[model samples]
Target: MKAAKPLPPYLVRRYQGWKATTYSENSTWYKHLANEGQHPRAMVISCCDSRVHVTSIFGADTGEFFIHRNIANLVPGYEPDGAQHGTSAAVEYAVTALKVAHLIVLGHSSCGGVAGCMAMCSGHAPELLEKSSFVGRWMDILKPGYEKVKDEPDPETRQRMLEKEAVLTSLNNLMDFPFVREAVEAQSLSLHGLWTEIGAGALEYYDPAKGGFYPV
Candidate 1:
């Protein structure tokens, strides 16, 4: 393997600054965490979008939340084919090993992955239809979401709805894992779905009783 390129100078400077100030202030806490290992109570599966700041939104400190970011914040149905499954592996470790009490799927507005799924489903993105296209294949997780909102007359509303659907789809798929289902049934673990409005900084949470999302 070839040697990897060094980090950008700006990032190195920012890291140095954090190490000098933030790390200095919390040196004891960081040392404790490193010694004890993490025991986060919740696992947050959020989007890869840079705008979706999980820690900032929840006001979480280091070692508080076990976070996994992926395209559209999706959780694929359990498929133990012995293939390389990063998201599933993360979920397995968080649940079976870490014993996290809650797992939250966090989606957001204006998601490019959701838009790509919509485009692919609506036949607008032929390139994404190819089997080898990684983005297209990953976006396939949102196909069910597209089907749910494909009939809407307004395009903008449909797109927004699909974004929310991504959260719902992941929540549903999380249950498909046998361990997750057992844990939920045993009342040992809980699953949650959340959607965020990037520009408004508003959040909506899924209500199982209402079968929809409500402002939080």
Candidate 2:
């Protein structure tokens, strides 16, 4: 097979700069992290959006949190059918292997994936109905969320509501995994849902009692 292409020159230059500055300044600490395996106390399953920087948002360092990124930051109901389930596999490793005490699902406003689901479910995006569309199939997980907010008349409100619903949907799905359920039930693990208004730099966390996301 032919070799893969190299990274763009800008990325190469950035990496070189990082190696010279950040890596050089923290070489010993980096080596220590390599020698001692990660023991993160939390795991964050978040969207693949470039604007959602998990590390920056939490002011985290290396070996801080186990994180997984996927479109819409979704989690599917547990299906141990032996198929390749990337998100589920990450959850399993974090909960059972890494033994993280907290699992967080972070969703953001104006999510393209959520918008796609809204469009598709409303019969506006026929391509997503195609059998070969991976994104469409993956986004089917959010249809139930759409159903809950389908009647909201205001477009912006509906969009915002659906985005938050994505977090709730994922939180509900996480319970389907036996390990996650056992750990949560045993008080060893806790689940959290968070939403952010990226442009405004505002963050809100879900309160099970309040039944809404509140400012943090």
Candidate 3:
């Protein structure tokens, strides 16, 4: 493979500083993790948004959470067809191999992917309608979620509703995986849905019994 371009000076300096300070301070723990392998208790699937910090929010240390970040934090319905499915592969590893006790789907407010799905479904983003658009194809997972909130009269409310729907949709889709279902039925694994208010640092959790998200 061709040599990759060097990182920007600012980022290189930042990494050097981290290596001199944080890495030195936690060198022992880092080495232990490398040698022992990870045994994270929970697997957190969250959005790729830069603002969402899963470790900071949970006060978790390295090796505590197996995290997977993707646009809109979606989990597609199970399809056994042979294909390259990054999310499914990660889920399989986390559940079947790692045996994580908890699977958390973490969504957040002001999600771009959710907004894009809303726009595409509302006939606003014509470019996303093209078959070759990767984001369009990925956001298709959340299209059903848009349908649930499209009827809401207020645009802001609709957008917020869809954000929460993204969490619920992922939670439901988790069960579509046979291994996930088996784990749940065996009471070995549990699923949760969470949504965060990015600016306010507030979190809400989904309640299956109530069929709504409640502040946490």
lDDT of each: 0.94, 0.96, 0.95
Give RMSD (Å) of candidate 3 vs. truth: 0.9
Tens digits of per-residue lDDT for model 1, 124-201: 999999998999999988897888899999988998899989998998899999999999999989999999999999
| Candidate 2 colliding pairs | none
**Residue ranges of candidate 1 with Cα displaced over 4 Å:** 1-3
Where does candidate 3 stray beyond 4 Å?
none
On lDDT, the stronger of 1 and 3 is: 3
Least well predicted 10-residue stretch by lDDT in candidate 3 = 1-10
**Residue 65 in model 3: lDDT:** 99
> TM-scores of all models?
0.98, 0.98, 0.98
Candidate 3 lDDT over 33-144, as tens digits, reads 9999999999999999999999999999989999999999999999989999999999999999999999999999999999999999999999999999999999999888
Q: Residue 16 in candidate 1 has what lDDT? A: 100
Evaluated at residue 80, the lDDT of candidate 3 is 87
Off by over 4 Å in 2: none
Residues 1-216, model 2: lDDT tens digits: 468788999999999999999999999989998999899999999999999999999999988999999999999989999999999999999999999999999999989999999999999999999999999999999999999999999999999999999999999999989999999999999999999999999999999999999999
Top-lDDT structure, candidate number: 2
